[model samples]
Target: MGIVLNQSLKNTIITYLGFGIGAINTLYLYPFFLGTVFYALTNYILSWANIIMPLLAFGMQNTLVKFYTQYKTEEERSRFLSFTVLIPLLLCIPLVLIGLFFFEPISLYLSKENPVVKDYLWLIPFIGLSMAYFEIFYAWARVHMHSVFGNFVKEVGLRLFSLFALIGVYYEWISVVEFIYVTAIIYFLACIITMLYAFHIKKPVFQFSIPQNVKDVLVYTFFIILSGSVAVMLLDIDKIMLNQYIKIENIAYYSVATYIASVIAVPSRAMHQITYPITAKLMHENKHDELNDLYKKTSINLQVVGGFVMLCIFVNINQLYVMVPKEYSGGILVVFLIGISKYFDLILGNNNAIIFNSKYYRMVLFLGLLLVFLTVGLNMFFIPRFAITGTAVATLLSITLYSLAKLLFVVKRMHLYPFTHQTLYSLAITFGIFLSFYFWEFPFSPIISIGLKSALVTLLYVYINYKFVISIEINQALDLVLKKLKIRL
Candidate 1:
């Protein structure tokens, strides 16, 4: 718990910094600097890449995390690592060949509705290939408990580079077309850096020998591909589908709303980095008691953190939208629906890590595939009728169903639950704070209004949680901060 707390806190700060930069890029730079067409194109390209990344990598990233600890000898570990690293290339080569043979047909299919996407079709696979290797290397680093640096490069470095690229577009130093190409280059660069850092942590002793548990390893990897694909599909498929059903520019509007709502997942994202490997190791050791304890602690702590974020977003949504362009103001409902969905995901804590590392993973993958179909079905039914708002509704429905299924499976099979009495208390407090602050407004600019309201909500929320000791872990964290500042709570 000590290491988890220290590293999660550090990772949270870094993740929030990354999101802060992303907020600027998503809200101001993309919409204001780049026109909606270019902004939507950029977002669409990246979303396409994200959806394809798992297939390109062939699930090696997750396989590495799940199996890295099972090997006992250095030679065995080397063989496993070597095999996982090369497996993706095998998948990548075939994919590239297919893309080459079918490029025209594929481009026409994607761009029939939005002709702007035709020119950028090549960027999708190229960026997806880069993103695939980035995750492969990131998982390599995570297994060594060296996640912060990789997290920084992934979360902060890419956004920082994008910020520069957008500035170039703004100043006319680079054309929008060049900026699009530069985006792919940025992902490839990040991949190279992460691979290098991973090697620095522990250089792989390349071995072509087969692992002892090759059968199990291969089986797990196969199922993980589905799992990884399902997860990515849930997150990015809406953007991709939106490009199909509506004008490309509407994606830019939806992207802004989704990005704002995504802040709710930051705490879960940060905590999962360290907790993932820890969870894997614990499950491998069959330490159910400790794993159960971790499950509850993470759930409550994340709820406390993520719930506050949702509260702030729901309360300040109007002011936040005022800062963006009027064209994007239509995504208010998108924010609320997706924000609640993400908050639900956060409170489940490291449920994902636990399931992915456990034997029940294959069953979850089956469920995931069904939900993927459901998501597409819902999107197809809703998007043409309601446009961007309908897409959000579809996402909300799919994620809610998916999350509930996962929660139930974990409870029934693993006999572990993330909720406690404090779970209900946390929800009640969140509702109370939101209702109290949703209508409250300040006579100031959007920025100042957000700041004042956020500060008030945060102070009140934290003080009440601390007073009740909703989570001993959170309370202890607050106590540590106060003591460091020579102040008493």
Candidate 2:
């Protein structure tokens, strides 16, 4: 718990700093500097890459985390590491070949609705390849208990470079076309940096020999590919489908609203970095008691923090939208629906880690495949009628059903529940705070109104939680922060 606290706090700060820069890029720079058409193109290319990355990487990122600690000998671990790294290339090379042979037809299909996408179809595989390897190396670092550097490179480095790229576009140093190409270059560089850092953490010893559990490892990786694909598809497929059904520029509008809601998942992402490998280690050792404790603690702590973030977003969304361009202001409902879904996801805590590392992982693949089809079906039905709002509704439904299924599986199979009495209390507190402050706005500019309302919400929420002690872990964290600041609470 101590190590989890320390690393999660650091990762959270880094992630938010990255998100802060990303918010600027998403809201102000991309729309204003790049224009909506180019902005949407940028988003569309990346979302396409994300949707295909699991296949490109062959699920090695998660495979490394799940299997790395099980080996008893350094030689065996080296063999396993080498296997994870090189096996993906087997799939990647074939994919590139297929893309080369079928490029024309694929491009025509992708660009049927919007011809702008035809010229940039090549960037998807390029960026997806880079992203796939980046995760592979990042998993290498995570298993070594050194995740902060990888987290920084992942969360902040890429966004910071995008900021520079956008500025270059602003100064006319680069055309928007070149800016699009540079975005792919940024991902490639990030992958290289992470790979180098991973090496620095522990120099690799390449071995051609396979481990004894090769069959088990390959089977897990095979199923995990489906699970990983399903997860990424749920998040990014909406953006891809949007390009097909509507004008590409609307993606920018939808992107901004989704970015605001994504902040709610920050705490969960930060905590998952360290907690994932820890959960794997615990499961391997059959430490159910400690694992169960981690499950409940993570759920409550994440809900407490994530609930506060969701509250802030819901309360300040109207004011915040006032600051963005009027065209993007229509995504308010998208934010609400998506934000609630993300909060539900956060409250599940380490459920994913537990399931993916356990024997029940194959179950995820079956359920995930069903949801993937369901997601696509719902998007097809909803997007033509509702546009971006329909996409959000599809996402909300898919993720809610998916999370519910995973939660139920964990409860039935593992006999672990993330919810407790505090869960209800936390929900009550969030609803109360939202009701009290949402309509109470200051008579000022959008920025000032947001600040005033956010401060009041944070203070009242924290004070109430502190006074009542909603979560012991959160109370302890608050106490530690107050002590560090030399303030009496």
Candidate 3:
């Protein structure tokens, strides 16, 4: 817990900084400078790349984490790392070749509704390959307990680069088409930097020998591909499907809404970076007691933090829309629906880590694949009628069912749960604060109003949670801050 909290705090700060830059890019700079069509194209390209990343990497990133600590010697570990890295590199050859062979037909299908996507179709696999190696190297660093730098590079570095690219578009130094190309280069650059840092952490021996547990590793990697694909598809599939039914520019609106709601996930994202390796280690050792304890702590702590962000976003969503272009404001319902789904996901804490590292991962993978089908079906039904908002509806229902299944599986199979009585208290407090603050708006400008109301919501939410001792971990941290400020509670 000590190391978890320490690095989690650092990662949280870094993730939010990245999200801040990203929020600026997604909400204002991209839409205002690039126009909604190209903005949607940028998002569409990246989303498809993300969907393709898992298949390209052959699930080596997760396999590395789940197996790294199991080896007994440095030579064996080196062999395993060699296998993880080299397999993904070798697999990309055939995938890329196949993609090139079918390129025109694939491009035609994707750009049916909007031909703006045709020229950019080549970029997806290039970026996906970059994203695949980035995760493999990122997991390489994480197993060595060196996640903060990788997290910074991943969270801050990419978005910071995008910020500069978008600014170049605004200043007429680069055209929007060049901005799209630059975005692909940025991802590849991030992958190279992370690989270098990982090498610095522990210089690889690059052994060509197969690992002793090669069969087990391969099987796990196979299922993890399905698992990873399921999770990524849940997050980005809506945007991809939105392209099929609606105008490309409308995805820009959905992207804005989803990005705003995604801020609530910062805590979970931060903690998962550190907790994942720890969870893997614990499950490997058969330390169920300690694993369950970590699970509960992560659950409550994330809910407390994530709930506040959700409340702030929900209450101030209207004010937020005021600052963006009017066309983008149509995504308010998308924000609310996606925000609730993300908050549900946030409270699950280490549920994903627990399942992915466990022996029953195959069962959950089957369930996840089924749910992906359900998500696609729901989108097919909803999108033709309601457009982007309907996409949000499909996402909300699919993800809620998926989350509930994961939660129940952990409880029924492992006999471990991530909630306490304090969970209910946190929910009640969240609703109370939301109701009190949601109905009115400040008389000032949008930025000032958001600042004033967010400050008030923060104070009241913190005071109530701290007053009732909702989470001991949170209260202890709050005590430290208050002590430093010489303030009494």
Candidate 4:
């Protein structure tokens, strides 16, 4: 908690702000205008960008976080940062060349539609290259203990830009196909902005210096590459698999459900951004007890926050889907499954942070690769038969298993746990609310039916939480607010 304890309120607010806008983009705009296939392709290509980006970055984002704190002086930090940036540039050439050489096979494998696949495949490396440096410079911000701007670019700026693009397509200002590629180009341009903004702040002096201890950095990079690749594989392989087995249109359906479900995971993503650098710093300082405590608190905090979100979405999923066309309703199930999978990740909290920042990370990386392999295999087995449902089931099972594996390792090896009374109560209350609405049925229009059900669900979940889940501090704060209002009889 100490590592990320500072400025958490601000970060949380920013995360919510980002999530609010992003929710509209995802839930309303995407489903309303894009249809299922395009919606899914949007998510798929973006994630695919991440899948290939790590390879291009040469795994230096992890390297930057790991090494940046070692330097005390600005000069030393600059040299290391420069070296980090330079090596990735040196690495990107090969990725471009390989991606060019392998474009058709990659496209054929990535999707069956393959309509604009050739046109879009070229954007992969460009987006990947941008991601490579975005991370490198973003790490620059993180190690400096600044999270707000990095998050602004990541969560706010890019999505806001896309919202305008989406509007452009809505008005036929740009063709949908062109807009798709344009969004990728926007990602690259945003990366440049992030890098430039980083320079504006750190203004790291890039002096020529010998790379520091090549052996250790390379060793770290090896494990991180495996870690990075496997992490991206798990996060993304579902849509990629969806493309291979199902129509690209199905990808759109899955994407909508995914967007709804994934909103619950945003807290973890934001928290992880700040927590990573702190974990790196903690491990270097050998503050085991502090690290363990922070890990537990983060898990509990995320569960409490993420549980509320998951409850909201899981309860009102029917209503939320009403905003979309009839065909995408199938994604509701996928939404539930994916939401649960992400919830498991939230419950585990900063286990990855603890592992990645620890000396024990390489072994964890090996275990992660195993999980990635299993996830791929399971998706292959299931997606052929169940389609979107199959993909959801595959993702849920694999992610839960992976989180459990990490949880057990951390408990066994470090003698730590992330659960307590609050965790139990939150889950119990959430489940009660979820099941409360599970039996409700209404004979009305989809819009009206959904709205009514969602309202009831929200009220019930809030009531349960206020009674059992919300903190004493929150209660006190509410009391203060009430007292200030001086309500009349």
Candidate 5:
């Protein structure tokens, strides 16, 4: 837990900083600077790119994390790394060729509701390829137990560049069309930088020979690709589907609301970077006891942190919406719906890492694939009738069902459960704080009101959790921070 706490904290800070920049861009810059039409176009292209990213990389990112620890000899490790890296590059060729071959009809289909997307069809695969390699390299870093730099590049670097691009658009230095292309270039550069940083972490041996367990590697990669695609599709498919049913501008609305809700996920994302490799190592070593301990700890700690963020978002949601445009305010319901779904997923902690690394992964992958169909079916049925609100409902239901299944599978197969008494206490505290704060507001500007209310909420929440000692790990963390600041608890 030492390295987990160390790196997870760093990653958490980096992710929120990224999300902070993203908040500004999503809430203010993208909407106000580019207008709704082009803003939606930007999100539409990126969402499609994200959906296709797993196939392009061939799931090497997750495959590396899962299998990297099992090999004994350095030679074998190098060979496996080579296999994970090169195979994805090789397999991407045919996928790109297929896209190019059917480019026209694909573009026509996607651009049905919004013709603006037709012009940027090329960026979809291009950006997806970039995202694929970025994750591959990021996994490369993670396997070495050095996730901070790669995480910084992913979380902070990309959003920072996008912020500058938005400024360029504001200054008339770049047209919105040019800004769109620039965003693709930003992703491409991020991929390159992460690759170099990965190489620096551990100089590549670049073995051309195949790993001894090529069969296992290939098989796992195949299942992982489908599963990875299922997960990404679940997250981004709402945006893509929105393009088909609602106007393109509605996606901009949906994106902003979802982005706000997604801030609740930062702690989970941060912890997973390191916990993933750790979970794989524990599973590979068959250390069930330690794995169960990790499962419980990650569950409670993430619940505590994620629940805090959710509380802040829920209480301040109305005030938060006041800052956005009038049209975008329709997503208020979308925030609560998506935020609850995400919080449920969050409290499950390392449930994903545990399942993906375990022997029962094949069954879970099938379940995930079926859920993908369910999500699409729900989106199709709901989006036309209810617009973005319907899409949010579909997302909430699908994600809740998916998360619940994973939780039950872990409990049944491994006899491992993440919830403890702390979990219940955390939930109780979150509800108490939310109820107390939700109806209260500062009679000030949106920014000042949010700050004042959030401060009071944070102090109250932290005091109660600290007093109860809901998690020893969290209490220890608080002690360190308070000690550093020369304060006594």
Candidate 6:
């Protein structure tokens, strides 16, 4: 319990820092500099690239997390590291070749409305290779329990690089075409730096020995590849499919809403990355009590923080759209629907880490593919009829079903639920604040009033939690931060 709090405190600080930068990028910079259309293009491209990354990576990142603790010998560990890194590199070459071979056909299919993606398909191999390398190094760093550097690269460094690209676009130093290449270059550089840092931590040798466990791990890797690709595709394929089925500009509208809504889920993603290894370690050490405690705390903490963000977005989203062009305001329901889904995910806490690292992890993926198919069906059905709203609806329902399935799996198999009274407490508090303002008249526009309401909601939330002590994890976390800062309180 203490250790989880301590790590979470550190992670919370880091998450906030990353979120600060992310907020600027998502809200102000992307819109102000790139415009919503170009911004959507960039986001959609990356999302598709990531969806393809797991296929190219062949599950090395996941295999790294699972097998790191199992091997003992330096020789064995070094061999495993090499295997993890090389297998992805190997997988990418063939993938790139296959993509190149099918370039015209695939591009024609994907770019039914916008064939610009054909020129962009070449960028996928570069994007995939970097994505593959970054995951390998990210895994290597996680195995050493040094998430700060990897997290910085992922959460901060990559954003910082994109920040520069936005600057270039703003200056008119490059066309959007050049902007795409520069972004891919940023990913590649981040990957190189990550691997260098991992090597500095533990110089992995290039040994290729086959241990008994190696075969089993490789089998697991194959399953993980399919599962991971499916997960990424579920999250991203809508934009790609939308491009194929409709105009490219519709993707811009959908992407903006998704980007805004996704910000609500960033804290959960950051915390899960830090928590996964520790959860794996604890489970290995027969620490079920600690594991369940951490899970409950994570669930409550995520809801509290995530609910506050959701309130702010839901309240201020109208103002936000005013900042963007009026056309994107067409996506109001898209933002609301997607935002609701992300909030539901927050309540699930570290569910992804919990299930993906567990013995019953395979079951999570099996159901995940089913949800992926469902998502595709929903997208196909909705995009043609309702357009962006349909896509958002599909995302909400598919993701909700997906999350419920994983939560059920964790509870049923482990008999460990990741919730508590405090989880309900957070929800109740959010409800009270929302109801307080639901019917209240405001002197100003939604743009102005929403911000004011958000401030009040944030204050009420903090005050109530301070008084009632929502989660012991949060209290301990505050104390840890205070002690670190040499404050008596």
Q: lDDT values of the candidates?
A: 0.94, 0.94, 0.95, 0.78, 0.93, 0.79
- Error of model 1, residue 480, in angstroms: 1.2
Q: Residue by residue across 174-229, what tens digits does model 4's lDDT show?
A: 87787788898888888899898888878867765756677788888878888888
If both were scored by TM-score, which would come out higher, candidate 3 or candidate 4? Answer: 3
TM-score of predicted model 1? 0.99
lDDT of 5 by residue, 374-439 (tens): 999999999999999999999999999999999999999899989988888999999999999999
Q: What tens-digit string does per-residue lDDT give for candidate 3 at 435-486?
A: 9999999999999999999999999999999999999998999899999999
Error of 5 at 287 (Å): 0.6
Per-residue lDDT for 1-489 in model 2, tens only? 999999999999999999999999988999899999999999999999998999999999999999999998888898998998888987688779989999999899989999999999999999999999999999999999999999999899999999999999999999999999999999999999999999898899987777899999999999999899999999999999998899998899999999999999999999999999999999999999999999999999999999999998999999899878899988999999999999999999999999999999998789999999999999999999999999999999999999999999999999988998989999999999999988878999988888889999999999988888889978988898899999886
Better of 1 and 3 by lDDT: 3
Q: Any idea what lDDT model 2 has?
A: 0.94
Checking candidate 1 for backbone clashes, the offending pairs are none
Alpha-carbon TM-score of each model against the true structure? 0.99, 0.99, 0.99, 0.91, 0.99, 0.93
Q: Report the C-alpha displacement of residue 103, candidate 6, in angstroms.
A: 1.8
User: Superposing every Cα of model 2 onto the true structure, what RMSD results?
Assistant: 0.9
What C-alpha RMSD separates each model from the true structure?
0.9, 0.9, 0.7, 2.9, 0.9, 2.6
Q: What is the lDDT of residue 217 in candidate 6?
A: 87
Considering only N, C-alpha and C atoms within 3 Å, which residue pairs clash in candidate 4? Answer: 1-294, 36-252, 40-252
Candidate 3 — number of clashing residue pairs? 0
